[model samples]
Target: MSLHAEPEIRPVPPRPAYDGTSPFPRTAPLLRTPGARWQLAATAVIVAFPFLAVVLAGWVLWGNVLGPVDVVLAVVFYVLTGLGITVGFHRLLTHRSFTAAPALRLLLGVAGSMSFQGDVIGWVATHRRHHAFTDRPGDPHSPFRYGTGVRGQFRGLVHAHVGWLFAGDSSPADRYAPDLLADRSTRALARAFPALCVISLALPFAIGWAIGGTLHDALTALLWAGLVRVALLQHVTWSVNSLCHMIGERPFRTRRHDRATNLWPLALLSFGESWHNLHHAEPTCARHGVDRGQLDPTAAAIRLFERLGWATDVHWPDPRRLDGRRQ
Candidate 1:
């Protein structure tokens, strides 16, 4: 499709007449679609290759192939792309936690795209749907998907972490992200996702070659800064979908069956996104780590942007709202 061509937006089905049997509306199918093996294969490669790269990186570390430059590059990319997802995709695009300047918005979208997550629109759409359904049946990656039992939880944990990506039941961009679809710039960025993925790898490789002046340096940077970095961020984000709900303190009340939690160990890695309970409680809040002693780098970044005039109208936490949501 052409870059400027509008994305096809699937119509969200209208709610069926309520019979008072369930509060939850009858929703679209979760996983009955078939004949998407190509999509499944592609997802496997995207999910598996980075993991295999981590194994390769460990062996390379054993051989002393790892370098300080590679480590620095990895750290830099991780912070940039990680913020892209947390700040740009989740907060800005998905929930409108704040308004960003056009340039900053584009930059964040590109950076988040480089994180090797899905495109900006699809990511936002899927996440919005996740919020709309939460831990209920329509949630794309809920850990309680199977049931409350131990075996079901185990199966659900896997499904939530990575298995859901291969389920072929894609969230409809039209239904969930019509705003992005309507915007020419965002549409172009969505179209540029694959090329951005290549650049995500290439930038590190080129930087390493320029700095270290060797093919070995380039390849090592590709392995560490490119693939390993992606793998770490991928799993960290996935953990919020899996581990956060299953294990942690729920300090805030959420919708019925919403089990989002505050997993402190993941706060830094997820850029404070693992403060899942507060996020679900206040989806539009710019700060997920609202409580004292929580480190929220994503919120900090958004604050920096606001201070610099790149961001405006941030949905900073309200004490009254917090008090009401407290469990």
Candidate 2:
């Protein structure tokens, strides 16, 4: 089969409105059972190592000044992988906010895989599941999972931010990502995830070595541009799952129990994903920060893609729909 062949689009199954008194239906059993020791260990390493690198980075900064090379590399890689997650994984792949050329689609999947966020198919599937159940039962990660009480909310926030990664209940791609599974290109990209992760680190290291001509410089680049960059982006993404659901303005109304919010503080860092309320209200909209003066680099990138004929059928927001969803 042609790797560039467009796969059939499969619409997500409709979910019932959440009844306040009852839990949403349980999802099918995961590909792996809950709490596999190896998976837990890997997750712990992935989460902890990056944070430890941040601490190391601070110490390095204290002892020897941080170089411009490291800073530039960090920012560049962060934007590359960050947009990979926002524009590629979320908008193009998961939500189908726009249709991209096959080459662009492959580039995005590869870029996103390097972010250490998991395979594209799995990421899309989990996110789709999150939307299917929202903040109610069956949501893979929800800040309200523990309830609204003070202590419960605190614990829920932690769970939503990073604890959910350890929950061990994987979203089954076969169920939630049938379209990607059918696409030969995506399946190949998923298989290359581990290699892409290595390249993510190696590329920074090689660049640092070439530019600085020292092993120390290369190691520092691996730390800042690789581990620290991953940590920052991961936490920013997680913050949306946690803080965005618990605070800030809720100008747009979402489904019952969907407490997504528009948090400006995170707008620049999250590349406008902090405008979470509108996203929950209109999942397919190519633009999340749908207001004057609101920053949405992802949407801007999509606009560029549309102008270049690389993306089509873009789901630009409708003012009527936005007005109807306003709280």
Candidate 3:
């Protein structure tokens, strides 16, 4: 065998998307509407804890606020819970991109529940609705909802980033996620969402307390791993909706109004979801980063599960299919 590389694989071309209305109901207006009670409660914790951490860091911990252990704790939990959403709530539940062993399925579901995003049913409903409508009128969070103008774009960005959460508009699971709603086990898990959030936060604090064996250490751990970690991941995930849509390459052709784009900057932070263009074009593709050098940790995890006999039916991107999708 030769030592140096001899051949290279060319990148695949983009594809066109359907320009159509979402199957989700279009009854509610996307204005200043109230969110669900569960949404309001979760938002409070996600906001309050991070805010508190900042204040405490400024007033008390200062230089000692984020230590090595705190960093490790945050990184570990961040990857774990992040995968829970990307793999469990998204690829597996929302798209059925692949199948997994019974135990692995349960593990992904439980881990994803810890993200404080929403119950599995609700999250899947919203996401499926997103893919269905994309950047059109029914999209739950589209940066182009307002208009293409400057002021409108700013408003749309803010709305897409987080404002849509409070807009009272929600995907009807009956239409978007009937499959999940029909599953008794998934229903039970959705019911336990609130409890899972508690564990998500408390577990970090407990781990910190155990490792450091001090009040300060425990608090710092909670601040970094529990509060800061959640806040960071939240923004990164939302950025896909807000930033990715606004700028970057749109090599793939979605609906006339759809504005999904590929942002390489967020590839690692978003676990390959930043390849928004590819994802919007191929929603069920197990790997968003299909090109060479495109890092997709979530896809890698799915592959690992396949190797461990945990996941099957992996949908690695096909170049021929992709090549046919060139704009």
Rank candidates, lDDT, best first.
Answer: 2, 1, 3
In the range 1-327, model 3's lDDT, one tens digit per residue, is 111221122222343443332222334543333445656666656655666666666755645445788889999999999999898888888777788787888888998888767788888888877776677766789887776778778888998998877777867778777777888889999999889988888988899899999987887788788877887888898899899998999877676767789999998988888998988777778888888888999999999999988998777777877776658
**lDDT agreement of model 1 with the native:** 0.86
lDDT of 3 at 126: 83
lDDT of 1 by residue, 1-327 (tens): 111122233645554543322333334545453555655676787788798886788778885856899999999999999999999999998888888999999999999999988788889889988987788766788877777777878888998999889767688777878888889999999889889999999999999999999998998999989999999999999999999989999999998878899999999999999999999888888899988899999999999999999998888888888998998
Better lDDT candidate (2, 3): 2
At residue 30, candidate 1 shows an lDDT of 54
Off by over 4 Å in 1: 1-37
Question: For model 2, where is the 10-residue window of minimal lDDT?
Answer: 1-10
Clashing pairs in 1: none
**lDDT on C-alpha atoms for all candidate structures:** 0.86, 0.87, 0.79
Clashes of 1: 0
lDDT of 2 by residue, 1-327 (tens): 111222233455676766543433556545354456676786787678788886888888886988999999999999999999999999999888889999998888888998988888989988988887789887899877677778778888998999989877777788788988998989999999889988999999999999999999999999999999999999999999999999999999999888899999999999999999999998888899999989999999999999999999888888988999998
Weakest 10 consecutive residues of candidate 1 by summed lDDT: 1-10
Clashes of each: 0, 0, 2
What TM-score quantifies how close candidate 1 is to the native fold? 0.90
